[model samples]
Target: MLMQIEALLEHIEFLLIAGIVLVLAILALEHKDLVYAVFFFGIMASFVAGFFLLLEAPFVAGMQIAVYTGGISVLIIFGVLLLPIFHDTTRERFETIRKKRLGIVLSIFVIILSGSLVFLFTWPTEIPAVNVDLAQSLEGLAQWLWGNHGIYVQFIAIIILTSLIGSLAILKLEKAEHLNPESGVYGLATWDDDTSEKAKAGNKSEDTVPVIMAQDAEEEGT
Candidate 1:
């Protein structure tokens, strides 16, 4: 009876944790404040680490907490801190959301993309039993690294570094573009060239109408 009760309690705990994780994920995605969203994500990551720990995967749990919960969270926070816009007290900038209809369409597109990605992930159907020699495995890894794998590893490192630099440049350029949108090929509305030209012509016509009206009034008085 006591064992059954304990089992029930464990299931309850798991359910509660799963609900909390779901709530945190929603909050992270939908939160108005970016900082609050970051906090929610960090907390969610910590809970995931705890979940891994519950499964008796201590090493994976530690990495989740250290790398995802701690390191990445700190990196995001520091990036926000470095940005001057975040420091501004009366910042009008808020996350721009797509129109509801567009979002719904995009959501469907995302679901399709996600399904494709999910199918691409190959899951092992059978676990093969093999005797793994710790020293031999390490030696093999080292030799592979020093040989054919070495070139690939170097290329991977270069790609990672380039991506990092490119991302930073994009962020900086994006911010500048936001500040001086005319300097870029795109605007906030990102109207096409023909649309912009039409709008300019419309504005000029509107201005000329006012001037013509003033001239008519002056001529009538004379």
Candidate 2:
């Protein structure tokens, strides 16, 4: 009897976890506000970590929290906050995004893709009794990252970061150049306010002539 009861309880617990994950995934997708969506995404990541914990995978759970919940969530939030598209009021910005048929189609496709992936993945029915020593694995990984292979990995990461920064800088420069009144991209000169003003001033100076009044002439004669 106790075995049957324990099995029932376990099934109920799995159902609850799966339901929570499903609900969060739907909310994250249906959410219109990017900020709210980010929070929902973080919550979803946390729930996934919970699943990893239930599987007796502490390292996976920790990494899910550290990498997805913390790092990726922060990056998403920052993208929505720091990017030009997010600088406006949420209504106008999202309304514009909503109007784009391509965006809508892409979003639907992604939702379908994610749902399909979830269905395709095989969820383990039971947790393993024995687990790998994550501490040793992590220690080995640390040594690999910071020892013999450290130089190449470090340089690769630096190059990637530099490339990202350079791309962002180029994008910003392009936008600024489009907005600039005095010059085009790459310091190319264009007809602008300064040029117009200078031309007008030159034309005025060339056209102007000194006039001598009759009264000035009489005073000079006297």
Measured against the true structure, the TM-scores of the candidates, in listed sequence, are: 0.47, 0.50
| Residue-wise C-alpha lDDT for candidate 1, range 79-163, written one tens digit per residue | 7677765342333221233455577799899989999987999977543755445565556656777675788888988998998
Which candidate gets the maximum TM-score versus the true structure?
2
Give the count of colliding residue pairs in each prediction: 0, 0
Residue 9: error of model 1 in Å?
2.8
Candidate 1: TM-score? 0.47
- lDDT by residue (1-222, candidate 2, tens digit) is 998997798778778888998998888877778678788889989888877766656777898999998899988888888866533224322323335777879989998999999899997766565655778656765777787687888798899899899999999987776677343222322445565456445543222222223444454456
Question: What is the Cα root-mean-square deviation between model 2 and the actual structure?
Answer: 17.4
> Which pairs of residues clash in candidate 2, taking residues 3 or more apart in a chain or in different chains?
none
C-alpha lDDT values of all predictions: 0.71, 0.71
* Position 138, candidate 1: lDDT: 52
- The CA lDDT at 148 in model 1 is 51
For candidate 2, what is the lDDT?
Answer: 0.71
